[model samples]
Target: MKSSPSARSWIAAGVRHELLTRALPALRHDMAAPVSVIRMALLMLKRQVAAPTVDAAACEERVALIDNQVGELVLAIRSLRDWELATTDDGISRSALVGQCVMLMRSAFDLHGVSLEVDAALDPQEDEHRWPAGAALRYLFLGAMGYLHDGADEAGAIRIEADGANAVRLQAVKRDPGTSPSVLDAHRAPRALAIDAVALQSLADDLGYAVTLDGDSVRLVLATGN
Candidate 1:
């Protein structure tokens, strides 16, 4: 059967539209690093320009804004560095990796007067299969809560449980019970949340896990059986 001219035109247009939509995103991502450099240069130019306006408070506010932007840029650079260090070409136990992260946050725990206890005790000689990389976010966020809510005295507690298999959940408790979800989740942006959400999402994306938060409880569920 001969296709109508309008039908043929629609098919051609759809194909071209799909190709451009996909290609444009790829092209933009490839150019992002250079574009970021150009943006930094422009910000520097603004900082160097002669000050025409004379309000001291306004100048201080601009300085604060620039400092915050620089801080975010620095954090992105550090996250890239962490991504490099987190991988091991050879197999490494997931438990050991999580232990290392706990040790790294040990000082923070002490500073906040929080106690950390791990329920998993494996024999040193036992050989368990290594889990996927990037699951350390659960540990990182659990430890961070210890540091963030340390001043809550007897009110703050962090509990982690393994629901058999690959499911894990971390629960943060406050005795006062007045803490709102906003206080716990804190970060309002879709791309930005509390350190816990940020780290959890990163690990979820890498490891194909489902990470979610409900009220004050945060959970990470690994999808694969093996």
Candidate 2:
């Protein structure tokens, strides 16, 4: 039987399946957005070309719009290609993995009415930090993360910081859902993140790392020593 830590990790692992399921609809939109515009532009261009009275400047404008939309379509296609090619190996670049995962799962986040953003502080220096490929997806979805001590950006994006080479800080600045949530959601609100904290701390302790939980955020670190 798996130990408690392993069991929880197993639970976290299931979230990836749910995330991909929710993300597909949004991914479809990403691929379709540029195509939709390109189609509209083509229709306009076609009308201009077949006009009984065509203006050179108007035709040029339509052609230019179509060109721009086509460029956008190319970028969308390329992003899909990259997403499909992303690796789920044991080790991967933290930044690239985080970015690709964010692109893949950000829409799933939207279902919870939250947006995830990583601090630019986690530049190449930290992005160079190594994390297991599947580990990151688990980490973000797990809800055990760090400080609201001015933790978010002006746009109120949840900040995922690089705590260290093998650590991550999650700071949530959430929005009001404007409804009386069920008891479960009320308990699960950002203000009550200690659930994740406690669970992670138990696992961290077993692994010789440490976790700290405050009212707003929890910082999980892979400490060099206790």
Candidate 3:
């Protein structure tokens, strides 16, 4: 089935943004640090080679440093490659995925003094359908949590509940009355919220999911089949 032009464009933009903002930066930093260290070690070795009398211990230490750096670089590359592979649409456990998302946001919730309650009953082994790839799932969670955290007041609570067989619901209540309207609100489009909302909705759509914002709650519905 062919997708609409706008959908295609949205998917493209979402992928580009994810690559640039998350994956590439992580890869660059992980790879660059070791490369820089290896380069420095090599230059030092070169200098030692030119010296009239090379200190054996110093040369051995330099060689060991270079070896360690190379090992670190290899591990970093492998880890990045594995992460990329995991983002494919191959099925993953729904329960596990949701748990991971919750774990990722736990720290932020603690820092904000907001409590989180998760009532997920979906069985990971029995649920054969995976909502989306790992990275996209993370992106969706990040976007949703970002929206919720911004709206939540100190001591407020966010509840993540699994609604029925195929839907995940995120509800935030007890918000500060004085707090400004949620970014998810159509009328007031704050810059950060606007960008995140668009990205989240677009990515969800591309992944065959539907996101609905009603009051202080957001529900993501997973498609029946791939």
For residue 47, give model 3's deviation from the true position in Å.
Answer: 29
Candidate 1 per-residue C-alpha lDDT over 1-226 given as tens digits, one digit per residue, 9 for 90 to 100: 9768575545434432332332243334434654566566556556655556555665566566656656766654544333332455343354654454455444444344444445564222267556554423333333234323432334345555555555555555554456454453443223222243444444344444466666555555544422
Please give the range of 10 consecutive residues that has the lowest summed lDDT in model 2.
146-155
Q: Considering every candidate listed, which one attains the maximal TM-score?
A: 3
Better of 1 and 2 by lDDT: 2
Candidate 3, 56-124: lDDT as tens digits: 899999999999999999987875543452345554456776775566556545545566777746445
Estimate the TM-score for candidate 1.
0.40
Residues 142-200 of candidate 2 have per-residue lDDT tens digits of 43422232233222346678776666666676554553335323322353322343445
The residue ranges of model 1 lying beyond 4 angstroms of the native Cα positions read 1-88, 120-125, 134-155, 175-203, 222-226
Look at candidate 1 and give me any clashing residue pairs. none
Q: Per-candidate RMSD vs. true structure?
A: 15.6, 7.8, 7.6
TM-score of each: 0.40, 0.50, 0.52
Give the candidates in order of TM-score, highest first: 3, 2, 1
The lDDT per prediction is 0.45, 0.53, 0.63
